[model samples]
Target chain A: MSKAGPPKSHPLFVRITHWINALAMILMIGSGWRIYNASPLFDFTFPREITLGGWLGGALQWHFAAMWLLVINGLVYLIYGLVTGHLRASLLPLSPRTVWADTVAALRLKLDHTTGRYNAVQKLLYLGVLALGVLVVLSGLAVWKPVQLWWLAALMGGYEGARLVHFFCMSGIVAFVIVHLALVFLVPATFLPMITGRAPAPKTNEANE
Target chain B: MKRDKSLIAATLKDIAPDLKRIERRLFLRQSLSLGALTMLSGCDLGSGNAVQGALDAMSKWNDGVQAALFSQTRLAKTYAPSDITPNFPFNAFYTEAEAPVINGKTYKLQLSGKITDKKPWSIADLRTLPQESQITRLICVEGWSAIGHWGGVPLHVFLDRIGADKTAKYVGFKCADKYYSSIDMPTALHPQTILALDYADEPLPTPLGYPLRIRIPTKLGFKNPKFITEIFVTNDYPGGYWEDQGYNWFSGS
Candidate 1:
């Protein structure tokens, strides 16, 4: 590790918001599963053991409570990402060819595990999940207040349609999380930097001296 | 070789505390399990833990927000007659077989509280009022909904006829089925709110509140109490059966 480069691989605000988002996501998803079991759209139900609240009423409490955390923290993250140009700088220039190449490399276990740089695949995933987050929140609002937020419900194709959209968006987020966690475990060095906000400086050819 | 070994040992010793701290933080993050979330929810009502208290406070805050967002002009969507759910599912805290069978002949719609006229009107007397019909959806808190046809006198017209105190905060219902609920004044006066006397153009079925029920499409199904025996206008919060148990009081849709 060299001392010549900037110490933080992730900015202070990014680390803080990331952890809060993680907490909020866990709470929301666990309770939301219990709520879904009340009137399941699909044949299968989420197992009771994995669900947060013991019953539907308790689950509703958790769902409504965690929503504020998710929304406010998400807003802070979005504003910071945009204003600081972190989002643009890290996730931009994502082309289809680059994504295809990265996907192949990732599958073959040949992609570079660069500490501070996002590859095209990573950029696409991050951007896609962010969009899903916004959609999930909007659809949730429509379901929660179909009459008061009639326009939103209409945009989602009405009350029943909004519920379907919300469920699918939640599914998308869960999928992204699975991949995100697997990547972290595969490159364990990345996990520490997310917590400590620093990474070992990238090895330069001249550093061999 | 001996000098290099000593230098490596010294570095390990220096970073031992930082490594331990990272491991501890990672362990804490990994232990964010469902069990921890269950404890945070404090699922048992009346247990006064900080987490439960915070959740309760947030639920109350949401109630206020919903109330503020409610608009007199914003009506629940009405469905075409063909859109009505065939055999709309019956829902209540109790089983359908337990639904009270009221004798429509002897039944009287009782009025109390802030109303100037305390007269009890019978089914025949209610029929004289102008009746309107709408096919509107009834959404339940359990995430299910059904659309049904309901015909009755608009509640505002009834309230006016009874000389109800329009400024009263709540209009509460006491039902023959022992289920009670209340709605805010604005909701009570909503153009679509009705004292429904018929379902599907037939004298209300026994399972569907029979003689009379308050048909409020704007709120959750629980808020629209069936088999209503008394209607009271009051300033006090008359918490409903389900609401007293933890459902948001102002659960406006």
Candidate 2:
């Protein structure tokens, strides 16, 4: 890769919140699976170890405890991302026309983030994950307090409907994680920017810096 | 995994590695939640950790908020007769095979606490008090739901007839199945909260809270006590079987 200098991709706050959000989501999903096990929608059960707290009682504690973290960190990310114009400037211009092209390009292993901006597919997925995070929180509130947030619960097709929506959002998030990880693995260079807050050191930039 | 309430104060503190680090830092930013809950609800700092106290206290805060928001006039959604699930599942701490089959022939409901009348009433007396029915979904916290027909005397009517102190803080039920529960005074008096005597217009089946039960449609199924043997009104906090075990006490569906 050729570049003038090694540009910073993620800032410290973004990096910290990203990791925190990731950890929180993982804990929430794991414990959420344990909770789902109590009265499963399906027949088979997810293994217990995958869950955070190990059992139903423990799982609930983790679910709720992590929920606070997810909500707080996510809010910071959202407000800072929006206010700083980072999310909009970096991930937008998600033209429907270009999205398909970007998807094709991504499939061909040509999608790159050397410029510190997300491609259409990346933009869509990042935006989607963000939206799903909000949905998870909102739907979670409905489930957590149906009467207090009765309107939200009713809007979500009632209590049971909120659970369904919550599960689907979880699935969406898990899918995003899978794709996100796979993309990072394929373009290993895409990984460091998140962890180190600096883009992969291009050959010329390594010397220049 | 499946222990009793004695573990709540402990479990709430045995923080997962990630949660511990995060909770410590987040506490500074979220102390407002702590402040609001404490100031608004007067949460009792029972023998528990900061997080446990916070979780329990927050749940209490949630109860106050929900109670403030609850409307006695509002009704749970009703369903058509055909919509009543034919195989309305029986769920309890015990399996269906182990559901208690009370001797309805000799069983009498014991009433106590802040009521003028402490007299015990037979199941027959209960059946004759007032008959009403509604078909509604029994939402469970664990992610499944079932629609069933519950028929009973409105709890408020029964409480009124029994000369219950309407301003009491709580109405507790002692179940024959050893599963006791209580509701807030407002919830106890909710129009839809009934002392259920029948299901599907038939005498309440053994599998479905045999002798009598509290059918509170506005609440989760567990909040509706089953196989009730006694009813009492009081200012004391009467925690439910599951409530003592850490489930939110005022869990309104």
Candidate 3:
């Protein structure tokens, strides 16, 4: 809103954490696909071409390794977002009516997008994906050490059930990513701000103000 | 337009050194992301020795984490007799037809390493020791799991009877099938660790380790060596067949 300052679309910390999160997600999901292929719950398996590890052993190594990065980096992101009020400023104040209206606008290809500010639809997707991320990690721990974390495993409906829950959470994240990437491609100018942390002020001062 | 272009070029030149430093950092990050992308695309770019080495190191670190989290008092879940998997599947590097068939009459459980007693005990001698039984799930690293009833002598009791050096770091096993594995002393001393001799209240079938096996409920299925011919206590790490092939050595389930 201040014309005197640079139009910052993202903070430096947010940019760093976002890219790191992207890397971790790719590693976790790719290796997870390979792990699933080892003993698929469904009849069909994930295609080898889309998997990370060359084999089950290799995949397990990658999955275990990337987990630390994901969890630690995720914690940093959450703490920074909450303590600095970045989370509230960027993504908050959503109602069912706003979401429905936004959804209708999106369907009609008429929704307006502003740099640094998430729309109602984006808010819901981001929050939903964040919740799914937490669940997937808990379910993973339950699967990894069912004996040590018996209570967690039980909460997820035991070892086998935990695996199913983990799988569904992963699916949800992948879906969000697909939609997110598509939106970014549609609004190509949104991509540069994430990298450089700033965007040129829009021609209309009223929108930014 | 020409003046603006020259002005931008002058700014870039002025910060060339800083740009170079930023580029170097970007290179590292980009390589990592690129490696991950290639791995997902099923390219061999991620198979380089550097990536493999990093992954191996991380796996070992995870091993340490899991060991620390393992509690002596925390026991694996036990199931009722009816909960046992019907027709428990036989699993091994070798097929069921190729599984070693040990003769109970001629079998001698050999002991070596740091143990004070190097004497060999026959199958009958093992039977004479106090026996225990439990129904526990055997989770495999491959993601499948099965529950089976196992009966045997507690490994710690056997170690005590054999005068095993409790201070030793590892308890290693040599199987008749040429398979080998080792476990940390803490895991070896876990209450659920047993030298199993029976399955489903009957003598072990040939395909299921015949005369002897280690039924460690705390570890993944591969850690439970079958057709064990020798047991040794030592400070040396005795890696398993699967473990040597990249499976984590301390694959605690």
| Clashing pairs counted in every model | 0, 0, 0
- For candidate 3, the per-residue lDDT at B140 reads 91
Which CAPRI quality tier does the interface of model 3 achieve?
A: acceptable
Judged by DockQ cut-offs, is candidate 1 incorrect, acceptable, medium or high? Answer: acceptable
Per-residue alpha-carbon lDDT of candidate 1 for residues B1-253, written as tens digits (9 for 90 to 100): 4335544665654454354345333322322345553445546432335565677799899988988999987889999999999997887755565578899999998999999999999999999999999899898998988999999999999999999999999999999978999999999999999999999999899888989998988998888899999999999999998777567888888
Question: Chain A of model 3, TM-score against the native?
Answer: 0.93
Best by the DockQ measure: 3
Tell me the TM-score of model 2.
0.81
Q: What is the TM-score of chain B in candidate 3?
A: 0.82
**Residue A36 C-alpha lDDT in model 3:** 96
| Chain A TM-score relative to the true structure, per candidate | 0.92, 0.91, 0.93
Lowest-lDDT window of 10 residues in candidate 2 chain B? B28-37
Worst 10 residues of 3 chain A by lDDT: A200-209
Q: Is the docking of candidate 2 incorrect, acceptable, medium or high quality?
A: incorrect
Question: Which scores greater on lDDT, model 1 or model 2?
Answer: 1
Higher-DockQ candidate among 1 and 3? Answer: 3
Chain B TM-score (model 2 vs. true structure): 0.81
Greater-lDDT candidate between 2 and 3: 3
What tens-digit string does per-residue lDDT give for candidate 2 at B119-180?
99998888778778998888786667888999989999999899999999999999987899
Candidate 3: where are CA atoms >4 Å away?
A1-3, A200-209, B1-34, B37-47
lDDT (CA) per prediction: 0.84, 0.77, 0.84
Candidate 1: true interface contacts recovered: 0.53
Arrange candidates by DockQ, descending.
Answer: 3, 1, 2
